[model samples]
Target: MELLEERIRRDGVVKAGGVLKVDAFLNHQMDIELFSQMAEEWKRLFAGKPINKILTIEASGIGIAAVVAHHFGVPVVFAKKTQSINLDGTMYSTRIQSFTHNRIYDVIVSTRFLGPDDHVLIIDDFLANGCALRGLLEICESAGATVEGIGIAIEKGFQPGGDELREAGYDLQSLAIVEAMDPATGAIEFRS
Candidate 1:
């Protein structure tokens, strides 16, 4: 977690409207070694949880989820941003508003991948407004799958997303939590 916080401090950029861009190491060009370290930390956090599958939303979440799944020894299931023609009729869908892109997407997951018996761990690259996390939770609920835990690469502590989940009694772990950011100064404050 300290390594991730340090990486964010070193490479993360602060933009207007409270946006913290971590594309250099996280969202865009990934640091696989750093990701592996984060995955190991997550494995330690959810050590005793019955994590049968790893679920995530597409685009940014796939790579981190894949790496985390490797540590869990489970298959990764990413919710599609758009329903492709090859996708079958049986699917669970939810609408999610993106804090970064400022758009809503219909996130879909195949029914075959999730079911009542599954104990899922939801993984994502960032948590801001909590909309995507809420949407993923809805999809898990639709399939009757239990969400054992939620793992995030970075969480904006200034935002209410992570706090809401923690208040709701969910086991959530974030590698780096940015408490504040100023675009003008390019200063980022990480939660200790």
Candidate 2:
């Protein structure tokens, strides 16, 4: 986790809309070595839990989820932002407000990929308002899958989402927690 926090300090950029762009390593042009380290950390955090699958929303979270699935030796199931015709049968769907994109998305997942038989570990690139996390949790509940834990790469501690999820009794682990950020000064403060 220290490695990640240090990386964020060095490479992350803060924008006017409370956005921390980590495209250089965490999300866009990725750093697999760093993701492997994060996967190890999450594995250690949820070591005893039965995690048979990794769930994440599409776009940014896929990269982290894939490496996490490798660590857990499970398949990655991403909630698609759209319903594709290739998916058959009943689907778990929920509406989520995107903090970054500033729009609502109907996220869906084929029920076949998740069910009572699965114990899922939800992974994501960032946590801000908890909307995305809540949508994923709803999908899990609809499938009757046990949510073993939640792993986040970066969490904006100023945001309500992370605290809300913790208060709701989810075992959420975030590698880097930014306590505060100032786009004007390009300054970031991390939670000690």
TM-score of 1: 0.95
- Enumerate residue pairs that collide in model 2: none
50-98: candidate 1 lDDT, tens digit per residue: 9999999888899999998988899999988863335467888888887
TM-score of 2: 0.95
Score each candidate by Cα lDDT. Answer: 0.90, 0.91
What is the Cα-based lDDT of residue 172 in candidate 2? 97
Best model per lDDT: 2
Task: Please provide, for model 2 over 16-45, each residue's C-alpha lDDT reduced to its tens digit, 9 standing for 90 to 100.
Answer: 878899999988899998999999999899
Which segments of model 2 are wrong by more than 4 Å?
A: 83-89
N/CA/C clash count, model 1: 0
What stretches of model 1 exceed 4 Å from their correct place? Answer: 83-89
TM-score of each: 0.95, 0.95
